[model samples]
Target: MAAFGQRKAQRLARADASRKGGLDERAAPVVQLLNGRARFCTTSSCSGRLVLAQGSAADANSWEVQKKNCTWLMVTHETCTKDDVMTALEKATGDVVLKFEPFVLHVLCQELQDAQLLAVRSTHCLEVPLSHKGKLMVSEEYIEFLIHVANRKMEENTRRIDRFYKCLEVALKTAISANNSPSQETENRSVYIHRRKRKTIQEQDVHTSLKDHNEELEPEDDTESNLAIFAEIMI
Candidate 1:
């Protein structure tokens, strides 16, 4: 624990090394929220991005644009326009790809339980190999179609990120509340025991209590519907 604390402090104190050289604006709030808790700290993140890159043809997969050999023609954290992608395509020299990368985050958890609590999966994004060896693989209409789909995915990604932030905030608060009250913890344990013994009768009461708790924690914006889709990778 001492070693972990020392390492975390050092990591937090160091300068950001990402390409943009700082925490992404959209993800900063959640990163700060996690770091504020003793049990977790964010190491890296991307709120999501739209990217158009040119890469070497010799790369194992024609569509796989490795950062080492690829040149980024366009990169934006926000939704992009068809003109933006078209302009970027004009600059492509090799294998060119259009991609909508979804929200990604890496966090260091102090314990196994902390990591498990945050385990979830996000929705998939779009990636199309728009050009192969300087030749367009698809029509201009298809490129526009890809852009529209990518933009929609970007919007969905933002909502997923927002949901993740809210869920984590509520979960952390609940954890802290549970830890601070020994009597409440004991009562919860007793409820668990009672439910196991008197399944039918105790289960209904437990369900009612959990429903009430969830209602209390739910945000005014009604983001609870897709709370299960938020993603986090724990290290």
Candidate 2:
């Protein structure tokens, strides 16, 4: 489809521009499987990774710009240790955060029906939390799935980092194992559109559908206070 092609092109270009090797190695197999399908294409992805960062502040406001303004104590594609986090915290002057992100991805589905189907299955089956951020731009004409591990945080940077590291390990295993089946892959590729093939989707209907997807992927909002006094470990 033209819409799918254009979005895919933009994603590929963005990946090509990345200095961190673009796509993460661990995410390649699942990305290939989804992209190879006619009904789905990945828009963006990160195969679970960790970050040790220092920022000016540690509040919800700071989190919005954390990535842009933060100082990287260390970043790893693999797991790290408490000592690793501690060492980094020693150099931490401002709010220090050790973020462990699970394998997360944004997928574009060809149809609203298909999006619903994928979303349902992804949550009930794949087990990773999926957020539907509808119609970001003209390019996000298709439905989008923002999949990620449960983001964990603590005010005690060191303690929270320890918990996050363990959480990341568990989430990574969940993501990898969830994709390890031939039957599961087959099901993911299956098309779900039916009955409304002729029904015209109106502009107003688009907003409604987006709302449904948001409800379908309900996630808790956790925006708390600043974090300080930390050590970071990098592996």
TM-score, each model?
0.76, 0.46
lDDT of 2 by residue, 187-213 (tens): 644421221221224434765887887
For residues 108-128, what per-residue lDDT tens digits would candidate 1 score against the true structure?
Answer: 998988998789876577878
With a 3 Å backbone cut-off (N, CA, C), the pairs that clash in candidate 1 are none
The top-ranked prediction according to TM-score is 1
lDDT of 1: 0.82
lDDT score of residue 91 within candidate 1:
81
Q: Candidates' lDDT values, in order?
A: 0.82, 0.49
Give the Cα error of residue 78 in candidate 2, in Å: 1.5
Give me the candidate number with maximum lDDT. 1
